[model samples]
Target: MAENHEHGKMDITEQEKTFEGFVKASIWVAGVAIGILVFLAIFNS
Candidate 1:
């Protein structure tokens, strides 16, 4: 286990970017879904 112990030495730029993008996409999708639901509710009466 000592041979693979790289504490605080791993390069994670790509991973960080991917995670940021994923979070942004999730927020956008959730917002769009809520907007669509609201539109339907307000118009389907």
Candidate 2:
């Protein structure tokens, strides 16, 4: 049996963070848009 121990460093850049935030915001915005459309359709019918 052999065992190995190793670790790697990870870092996130500002651009990556901003992009992640943008992705999250867009997802929420899309979800809200869908909900609104559904509400309008049901409300009018």
Return the top candidate by lDDT: 1
The digit string of per-residue lDDT tens for model 2 on 1-45 reads 224533433355877999999999999999999999999999998
- CA lDDT for candidate 1: 0.98
Q: Candidate 1, residues 1-45: lDDT per residue as tens digits?
A: 799978899899999999999999999999999999999999999
Backbone clashes in model 2, listed as residue pairs: none
State how far residue 32 of model 2 sits from its true place (Å): 0.3
The models' CA-based lDDT, in order, is 0.98, 0.85
Measured against the true structure, the TM-scores of the candidates, in listed sequence, are 0.88, 0.70
